[model samples]
Target: MKKRFARFKSGWSLNRIFHDVTGALFAPLLISLPVWADAQPIQTLTIMEYRAHLNSDQPTVRGMIKFADLVSEGSNGRLAVTVSGATVPGSPEDQIKALQEGGPHAPDMMLLVTPALRHVEPEFEIMDLPFVVHSDRQAHELLDGPVGRELMSRLESHGLVGLAWWENGFRQITTSGKSFIHATDLTDRPVRVIPEPAFVETFKALGATVVSLPYPQLYQALKSGRAEAQDNFASQILVGHLYDVQSTMTVTNHSYSAIAVVANSAVWRRLSVRDRNVLQHAAIEAGRYERDLIREQAKTDSAELAHHGMTVHSLSPTELARMEAMTEPVRQQFFRSYDPKILDLYRHQIGTRWITR
Candidate 1:
């Protein structure tokens, strides 16, 4: 019996049994690895997407497309974003809702140029006050500087996580019947304004009867004569082909409009920290690209407006000073309505003397 037990514990038999049991325990794990390993790294995720009347040829839309492309590349192909331009089912307000409530079941990111955010945060309209920014550089200084960062940081409470500011260039006035070399030319004439209160008030202050209209309807309004005058960035005026009806382009440079690229808070939280950093970096790079594109296009569109038979008029240095003077009342109104600290920080960063706040 002792001799038989010793043989059972010897090399080949014991080794064979141990190997068989080990294989049995790990067989399922080995077979299951390919299925687990081959799984998609990302199933569904927040993506930056836009659906606006902005033409693909327009700088804003071009910037948006480039932004999406950068994000996709930065994600190493794990992230995908789709950008759709030219009129959507609803107004900018509706798009914001879609992002907020996840109406389509998942809210992605958006590059919005509208002041609809005033509904969520009224202070946003302060940036839209007429003639607040004298040049694109000043706009950048305000946005990329302390003042802009503060405004952006305040957005966290408003359901929007502000990513970057994309320029839409300066808002210029164009009309079908007259050339507005002076603010008085707008007196009593109906001018279309965005559906924002500050815009409506500013135009009214400028002695025009303000007609609030959605952006998509502006070209039709001008053609149908519901409103004979409208204001937008030069690129939009050219892209919307409003020159067909509008006879004059006044380079009033009333308000320098900046679009905010934002993600809904809920959707933002869902991103892994690593992925979030990737998206934020991509957004900053896209913003830099947009700024350069706009500076070039602003010059190009001014020439194009003239080539299209629209008389392009720029505010003279004297007239620009007068226009700058008018902004004080608007800025004062803003401080009274919003917060003085905002305007104070703006003055501190850029110096109060450069801009007559």
Candidate 2:
């Protein structure tokens, strides 16, 4: 049966196509599937924060706060958030699993940075391409437009469902040993890259030896000289306090690092449509709050990092062109491997928006 089903490329799996249909057809012959219990009094909602290592609140945390308030106000106090800062789960993957379980140890939603979710939803790497999105406004256009919705739909196939988009700001490249002024400057250096394939490809194309690592270990890798540079948003470097060890911050815009508020499908299916609407609105409110905080803080954060003796470099247009060219291969590779509709959607919409401008 597995072999036969594997032959049908692009065909919907029987289980997916007829989950309810089969249940109804077989009702007479078998016991019914267990119905989920009524939602417990929604006194508190838990959000897992990865902020134990950082001293100050990051944009992601700020977004969570806004989301909680929106939910409480929208639900009129029936739903409230219980923020479990670094207490709920250790890693993004662990947090995702916790949401899937949906019980005493579960969260109704988990905020995941793109890399962690990339394994489950690789097509999202569209935005992860180096220098693909140049500004906050461009990022917003992509996320809220048709391309973003098309990418979000892939979450269901991977067992997670996307609720709303949140910002983490654009990634900047930083190195302790050297400054990245040109694409060739990356040659022969071991750069710490997010574990996502697109990131790995981007670095490799620029002539760097890419090391795939999780976010939690990156600063140590730099401090110990095991790696020379890393890429992340300004908020992460500041909140994670990576500037203490790294000396140079380059405005690379290598990728857009955003968070997705996602729910496990099983948990979502049990909620009433009314509850779902509340969740959706809360998520949008949180996303807006996050975007505003990031846009307002990034320039200030860069200046502050410089005040602390970290050398900052904004690339010239020629150098920026070099960096952008390095990512073309990654773009081609991704489009080849991803769904054609997803590729076309992005091209058409992103192109249309560009032309109008």
Tell me the tens digit of each residue's lDDT in model 1 across 1-357.
000111122432111111111111111110001112225454233333343334335555556556656765677655544443222246667767766765454446777663866666676776788776778788888888887788778778767788888877788889988778776677899899987877887887778888899766787888888898988888878657888989998888888787788888777788888777877888888898988999888888888889999998786878767666655576667667766677678778767653443
Model 2 TM-score, all chains together: 0.82
Count of backbone collisions in candidate 2: 1
**Candidate 1 whole-model C-alpha lDDT, 0 to 1:** 0.68
Candidate 2's C-alpha runs over 4 A off are 1-43, 50-56, 87-92, 352-357
> In model 2, what are the clashing residue pairs, if there are any?
45-82
lDDT of 2 at 331: 72
> Could you give candidate 2's per-residue lDDT for residues 108-194 as a string of tens digits?
677776766766667776777776677888888878888778777888776667889987788888988779888789898999997
